[model samples]
Target: MRHLFLNGPVQNGPFTFATRPGKAVGIRLAAALNAILGLPPTPHLWNTVTLAGDLRHREADGPTIPRQRFEADLITDKYPPGQFPVGGIMTDTDAEVARLALEMIENNLCAGTLTISRETVPSCRACGHMTGTGSHPCNACGSTDTEDRTGLHLVAELAKDRPVLDRSDIHASHRQQPRHLQNTAGNVAERLILSRTRDHGIDLSPHGLDGLVLDPRVGIHVTVLAAARRHEADTAVMTITENAANHIAAHGQHFREHGGARLQYALHGYLPYDHTASLQPLHEAYRATQAIKESFETWFLPLFSLRTKTATSPEQLPALFKHYMRAHLAQPAEVNAAAFNAVQHAVGAGNVSWITNKQGLANVMAARRAPIPSAAGPAHG
Candidate 1:
């Protein structure tokens, strides 16, 4: 058994917790998950409108919160560098309270406290000007102490459960033909007709397209997973690609081999088949898109094995989710030409602007450049 110890000032000093129950879950607990699945040391996601009545989510399911005991002896004693008596030298101690406190700390860790380590120190950055015989200058920065900055802090590490992808074209180029076809020109063309009818909920017969090629960038869709860590509010995005899909499969296998639970999984992409107009052609195309998307998910699943240990692979995930687990995967609503034109009109020229329909890739990327409309709010596009 191995242990990780982080320093912090959260009442308890050093503590230990178990990752596994009596039996190993087969897969080793992800270190990143351990780092995040707990109460945050700072208030970034959950907010408090008032003190005492603080509004923050606490750890209900974390490693430290588990009620199991592991077989081991963890001892913390301050002793001189010499041989000492084994059982007769303790001058003062409270073993029962100490044991209870350790148990509580373990419980909290199991409940996702995410609290690794902490410590309290004087406000050295602001304490630079106080002058007196007994008064001491800031230990960090030499100045008279004026104010105190005291609070709990954590030394944290992050773990991720996302599939990695290689941005290089070569990696994508080697994926199964179906996946590549679905991502490239073929799926793009299929999506244009699907979006027009499916998104508007209308018929597609009136607008004739005997000969047309849809644009890939404007039509192809991908699902993204989003999750957050303790103390962090920014949602991390994970765009599932061929490589990522395969990685998940491989990871599952690795878990099974290592005395872990076996996962019979499927990468299910949500299909959008809703349409307002009762056009036959539109309905046919909408149905076809949904079928194709489902087929793609089935086709992509059997191409890989689970990974036993961490190793280098050729994969690329978006920048925001390069290092964490808990991501989301969803197909965003399409942005049409008229909507694009409207966004341009509203933002005006000279100043740069982007267009997206709150739920697609464009909108996700556009969110970084400007204040994209909230899901419940209206926008020019």
Candidate 2:
């Protein structure tokens, strides 16, 4: 396949989408786009390799469970019972992801783009966590006491041939390129330490960097590529926010591509899901059902965020809901192949204008309602 949309692996923490809809924005956006393209639903990517996860596991006083099982259980609980992701879930710490990360590391090392070198880095005196260079308290244990720790570390030697992120690395068209992000994401040191102190991660033990793990920033990219590789997708488009893309862009410099597959960031914005309450009046006016409201919030707003790129304010909710109502009203009785093809072209071209265009939106809605043709043709047609 040419392009497959995947979420920038979301951090698996103790939060539900019911409580924090914003966190699921990337996942929802990816699902919406992939559905439009008629691709099999991509696995929901998750980031479970955080210090907080380590702490959560340590603090739990129940029957002992493996770290991988612990994270998987937590992720399963995040979704409603039997409402799990259609394509299932893949985490950063999954064996598939670990395998891919190691493969990429070895390849980069062979290509001289990465190296195992002993370097001094600040370490938490209490917990042995890499505190990085800052004098601030350790992120893991929150202790200010630290010491310089030197050991074999995985170091990434960024390419000088091009910026960390460029137009080709983004899923947007040339006219919609994120110039600011392209410039800012490159603002990092020439060399980056890709190894980190974590209880559980893609261990670099094979490379003699025992006890160290690949950084989550880089693992996140691997998570996407692993999924893409499974689907045989040549290009994996990760749905992420501009801020998130900026944060991981540097670390993912070399991890974005593996084998013949490549990864690109599709920048989206924050949605004021908290303010969706304000749409109740409009919902009542349009006689929106519970499912209709969900479609607007979960499906439509996420696509709109792709265009908004900043923040969708509460004040805009009413108008956005009204626009959706109009599109819903315009939904055709039968799916129009020509109109739907045009919408697909727009999506593939990184043009999100059709999201707000009533006719285009209706065409998409109609397509979603249309029955899928069975592999053996309609059973009773």
TM-score of each: 0.16, 0.96
Residue 256, model 1: Cα distance from true site in angstroms = 12
Candidate number of the best lDDT: 2
1-381: candidate 2 lDDT, tens digit per residue:
489999999998999877888999999999999999989988999999999999999888732898999999888888867789989999998889999999999999999999999999999999999998868998898899999988899999999999999888998878899999999999999999999999989998999998999999999999999999999999999999999999999999999888989999999999999888877778888889999999998999999999976899899999899899899999877666677888888888788889989999998897787763333433133
Q: lDDT values of the candidates?
A: 0.22, 0.90
- What C-alpha lDDT, on a 0 to 100 scale, does residue 291 get in candidate 1? 45
Which tens-of-lDDT digit does each residue in 216-280 have in candidate 1? 11111100010121112222111122333343322111111111111121111211112212234
- In model 2, how large is the Cα lDDT of residue 42? 87
List ranges where model 2 is wrong by over 4 Å.
372-381
